[model samples]
Target: MTDKPNESSEPTPPRTQPVVSGQAAPSPYDSPTGEIPVVKSGAGENVPRTEDELGLDPEVPGVGERTEPIANRPAEEPTEPVTPAYAFASIPPAPAAGEGGLRRRGDYRRGTLDLGLLGLRLVVGLTFLYHGLQKLAGWFHGPGLDQTRAMLEQGGWKHGELSTAMLSVAEVGGGALIVLGLATPLAAGAVLASITDAWLWKQGMAPGFQYKPVELESILVGLAATLILTGPGRLSFDRNRGWATRPMWGSVTALVLALIAAAASWIYLHGGNPFTGFFD
Candidate 1:
């Protein structure tokens, strides 16, 4: 017998579709679009598509759907433009005082200065108020208006009642306004004019314009001028006002007018310039 190869012992070729009489056999990698086929490793398993697979063009095989990278997709554009972080940050954040910021450096010092100014205002205002009440209503063992008028007349005031009334009004109205810090410049000016006249009156009564007799009046005049120049500070009704923050030309003008009124009162009403006596 011829030694022919046994059919059961020979290796079998891979199973494939039969070729037509004049056509080539189709390959496992060949598809209708002429692109290579994709074989997933985990067959029948729900394997998530990779970024490359997700980016494939639906119309074209083996091509990306978008020109941009998978990370920069058009579907994520709406959320990219939206910045939720700044939705509630309308105003810029400000550092608090004492936190090493230049803007808030003097906040604590300013607060202490305002408090000191408030205490000074209270003391000066209450003193003037007490004296005003004494003259107007004779409260606190003070001379009544009638007695004040007589005293002014005896002291060479031609219009004693008018002088007493003007003094009372200046003390009461100016002191009250200064205490409340309302119309601070005007109130200080009124008090300054009256106090200036009182200081001059004392100077005229003393020998050779002595300072000892009118020391108290001088201090009061200085206090009134200080208020005119410095304003009522931040603890007053005038807080945030131009005069309170920056007492400039307007306060200077008020001081000038007050001094002029004082000199005029001494010249016209008293018939003598007490200011000229200072030189002697």
Candidate 2:
């Protein structure tokens, strides 16, 4: 019968059908699309897989809950990085200060700026008050009304009596108002005009920063201008009456009015022209 088949080459046995209660089980479902369904372990579906079984680290660095293979997992939409719950335990960061780290509210209160303005007001206001008293009644070792009148006439004041009286009233009344912080704008304007008028008289046709030593008129003018710009502090009558903290427009108007009054007073006293005295 020719060469006989070797024992090692004997025919392999075929797979037998699995039986369930004496009936044959059906074959696995074969979809037209050929997609394979998920498989589970034989121990049970609810049981968790340990690290030994999965061959992965027990404490992976950036991993969260729901341990599944990345390839098998469904893709998720991207979102912003989430802060952990424990991150809240740390203190929150502080906010940065604005605008060159300055806190210039410029309010009419007893704060840093208010106190400074108060001090300045007292100094200038009291000084002017003393001068006013001196011109009015010869107090503070200054010339009296008669001498003031004589000085006015000598300084080219045509209507000496009228000019002298106006200056006296302006100084005395404006000084009082400034000291009390009442009608601050009005007080500042009046005082500023009076200082400018005196400046003209004192210069007496001199030109440009000539006389040194004290420079009383220049100092008074600066102080009065500051008041016009800064307004009275919270400690003044104006603050109490809601007239303090006037805007920039108000300050500009006050300065303009003061200059106009000063020019008028100068022309009235000089009779001819106050401009001529300012130049050579």
Candidate 3:
């Protein structure tokens, strides 16, 4: 042995630490203070390297940082779901028909409403009819056509003959139709137009002196409008017609047409503005 050393025992190579970014890597036993003591088994055999001997810091995890590996984390506890209270509630029943209750049947006051309409028609129709006859035939001590024509001319109405004719026909014919409840919407429209002219005239739109206390004309206009909207009722000739029981779109159309016609007649035939009064 002394004479010739064995090749394996000739010289052992030096162990070198791994280079990490040109710096020597620390050994597993390296610590901040120095090399850490290794734990051993009871038989004096070395135990597998613990975290303390591996040079890792023993600091606790901060907030938001994981304390354990994902595979080692405990499963979250399951929660019981809540249900809505109304889901099991009962529905309320509908109210029965009675006083202050829902009306589920036909109108019981139909007869009363029809009677009221009849009375309204009579008063309006007869009043207009009387006036119309007075102007046309000199009835009830009224001036006849010649006098009426003269009166129109004095009241700033041009085309006296045509104006007188139209006025007489609208009042007389329209009044008669309203009384009989025949073509009620047209009758109401005609009367409405005539009354509107009268209202304008009384307010001194024409050359005549302004009439004080125009309540009669105002009342007449309102009544005419009421009849137009309410229909003729079941007591008259127009009972079978739609306008008789239900004055809706057709009634509104008739009213608008009547108003247009009245405006046209006043402006064109009378040569006067309906909106302006004598003072204006």
Best by lDDT: 3
Tens-digit per-residue lDDT, 78-174, candidate 2: 9999966675567765647765334444342335766777777787778778888898899989898899989878767788788778888888888
In model 2, which runs have C-alpha deviations exceeding 4 angstroms?
Answer: 1-110, 205-214, 240-243, 271-280
Off by over 4 Å in 1: 1-109, 275-280
Q: Pairing residues by index, what is the TM-score of model 3?
A: 0.59
TM-score for each of the candidates: 0.63, 0.57, 0.59
Give the lDDT ranking, best first: 3, 1, 2
* lDDT for residue 258 in candidate 3, whole number 0-100: 83
lDDT accuracy of residue 153 in candidate 1:
79
The candidate maximizing TM-score is 1
Per-candidate Cα lDDT values, in order, are 0.80, 0.76, 0.83
Q: Compose the digit string of candidate 3's lDDT tens values, residues 113-214.
A: 899999999999999899999999999999989999999888888899998998898899999999999999998899889888778766665444444546
Which should have the higher TM-score, number 1 or number 3? Answer: 1
